[model samples]
Target: MPKNVKPVYYGDYLQLDKLLDSQQPHSKQYGPEAHDEMLFIIVHQVYELWFKQVLHELRAIYKEFCAEQLDDRALQLVAHRLRRVLTIQDLMNDQVGVIETMTPQEFLEFRDYLVPASGFQSIQFKELEIILGLTRDTRIAFDQQSFYNRLSEEHRVYLEELETHPSLFDCVDQWLARMPFLQFDDFSFWDVYQQAVQNSLDRDEEIIRQNAADDGQLETELASLQVNRDNFSALFDNERYKSLQEDNRVRLSQRAMLSALFITQYREEPAFHLAHQVITSLAEMDEKLTIWRYKHAMMVQRMLGTKIGTGGSSGHDYLRRTTEQNRVFKDFFAMATYLLPKSALPELPSAVRQALGFYFRHDD
Candidate 1:
């Protein structure tokens, strides 16, 4: 390492002067400053800082996925970085409580001074969403049109260009789709999986028929079981799965979904361990982000109730919609619905098992 030309001061290193000076509240311009406004500004500024760090980590992960191949080391780094993002998301969620310290009445004191600006205009957060594969079409109506219109011209153009690139979600889907284990010579893993699934469904139906209280309950249970049957069947039907994709019922491609299932099912094997960790981390990241959005929405309801946002959004209502719909990795969570018990899973062939492990037997 090169020696420092000049000894660095702690405050100077972090630009604390500018940071400390940035909390100039508009409330001070009219009359006696509202005390909570400073707190609000500081909280939002801290959020943006964290958003910047999250974007940095996401971009690195994206680059790794963009590679033609991801070795275990690369996968490990991706999982580690995703874990860090989740930790940051947890902190962000908890920060909502800090801002909630102010009452609605106190928020009203300075709220009027901040017109034409809202959380919707947070370019970094928007970029984070975009990089995580939130397409314009996938966004809610307000975000689809007005979100970009609200941004400055430079920011708008930049994000528009960014949308042209493959996002982290796209990269991950491609990576999983290209996984080589789905077809090993003549071995068809999905066929075995299908039979196991059918056997499990039959057992469930038998249990339901025996345990139902009455005719109406039996009918209801059978209908619900039929829905599961149809969904499981669709996993192997290309045309039916494509229809589900068109309806946005599922996001991952059929091949990728199957590959994810295979990895998840065989995660105990040496080769699949890191791959499963990466998949699990991505799912957890999505969950944490959803939790953050829910907390933020509740905080908005507490602060403004039915009032519209400063930037013309529907306040808590709009936030609630985003909390529910703006998900990129939800298919990972839904995959759990298709999992069978380990004991019921088809035992892999010895050769396939050897391929999925670190050691192989040597003939002398």
Candidate 2:
């Protein structure tokens, strides 16, 4: 550690003077100040600050994933940082309630003063989304243009350049695809896994058949079962899985999907523990962001019912749609649908189990 350089004052270190003075309500510029406008501005400013921290964490995580290999220590650090992001996200979600305290009538006082400056112009938030892999194609129709169109030319150019780089989702896919345990000599894990899945599916079908009281009900249950059967079939079939990817039913590459599924299934294994935690944390982060979006959309509705956003967006409607569609880690959540019970999972071969564990047997 370096010796003391200069005396650091609290306000000077945090720039509290600049921070405290930054909140200038637009309403105050034209007419009597809207009291609640300060709260609105501060709440969003806090959100941007939090967004900055999240981006900081994500850049570090992205650099780690960009490596050719992620060792256990690296994976642990990644999980820890991701959990930190999740914690911040929880705070962001809860902060919506603070803004909600400002009544709709109070919001109206300053709302018209802020023209052509909607939440859509939040460059940090958009950067966070792009870095996390919500590409143009993945966005909803209105959002595909609105997100970029609303940004200033400089911000648009910066984000476009950012899009050229691989996203966290892309890096994660590559990492999972490169996982070493997908292959072994004289052992076929997926073969055994397939048979177990088939057995489980057969059992489910039998139960459904027995429970059905009429032909129509039986047909309906069978149709649903067939969908599951097709999904499981796609899991092992590369071409079929690619078809699913084409249909946008899934996103991760087949190899990466399989690796993620394998890690999730045997998360108890020493090597898979941190890997599983990384996936779980990413999924939770997505959920928290979605929750924030939903809360924000509701807030927008309260403030501007059926009103177009200042940035010419559909306001709450657009936000609500984003909550459902604009997700980067939905594949992780959907992976749960394909997960089989631990009881149904085939016991890993001893050699493979040993490889996954920390300890090695020594022959004397």
Candidate 3:
């Protein structure tokens, strides 16, 4: 059967090659302890690979968006990509749930062997943060302060090269500006917004597009975004605007549109609301991932309490900082409670403060 028909070589060369040899333990120390460490290492490596794919798709999706390639597919691709990310995140979350079962003294023996091998050096993780609309302005970027200094030059350069263009959210705004939908309803407004987003995506896949990835250009081309200053103010308060515009210098769009998206209430154009939804969803994903880090930290701390990390970090405290600082989409969380109805917004005081943690929403 094989000679007559050339067998289908079902091998994905790049993937198989990378996946098979990806997990490299720091030492020859192989025991039952290595079992959990291997589990720890393999899970993260696999997820980073997946994170790479997310960045690839995000860049492509963003490019299509900038070209004014409005359609429902554009919006859908994001959910598709993100759903996969969330699925893996859920898997990672479960992995954390499992790892958390380990005791502290058990973690101490080999923790020292892990010198400079912290997840903080994960290049792909940093890229994921950047693509999701986080920037260097946040505390995470300057984090080459500790074991993070262990980041390979390759990781550093890759991040430095990232276009930092208008993100998936910016693309959504460009799509929303195309139609005359007054509100975030299920009929014309929602349909147009949905279709326009998808249309933008399909247009990208089916056709050759341009370098519309940069927000500076996309904003100019799709300049008629209806959500404005007064509209933004009316739907939400001013601090809401500031919370959303944490990285005011990135210049994804004019501050008006950016803040309007994060802070403003749902006034017809679901600018703030959609941004709020995506931001919150992404933030949830980020929070889930932090669970993994904290679990890792706890393992290290329990095993080698108040000791140094294998990756040359301050161990528990270092990881605590990571868990606190690793938010890829901070504004989304900082402004989450505001996504609820005004009445509901008031009830969640902690969420309210977190959302307003970044900035004031007022204009002038």
Candidate 2 wrong stretches, greater than 4 Å: 357-364
Compute each candidate's TM-score over C-alphas. 0.96, 0.96, 0.58
Worst 10 residues of 2 by lDDT: 355-364
What are the RMSDs of all candidates, in order? 3.0, 2.8, 16.6
Residue 273 local lDDT, model 2: 79
Where does candidate 3 stray beyond 4 Å? 1-5, 9-26, 29-37, 101-106, 140-148, 163-280, 290-300, 328-364
Q: Determine which window of 10 residues in candidate 3 has minimal summed lDDT.
A: 355-364
Q: Distance from true position, residue 240, model 1, in Å?
A: 0.5
Q: Per-residue lDDT for 12-34 in model 3, tens only?
A: 63567767787766544554454
Q: Write the per-residue lDDT of candidate 1 for residues 303-362, one digit (tens) a residue.
A: 889999999999999999999999999999999889999999988888887765532122
lDDT for position 203 in model 1: 98
Clashes of each: 0, 0, 37
Q: Candidate 2's residue-wise lDDT over 135-195, tens digit each?
A: 8898999987666787779999999999999999999999898775667896888888889
Sorted by lDDT (best first), the order is: 1, 2, 3
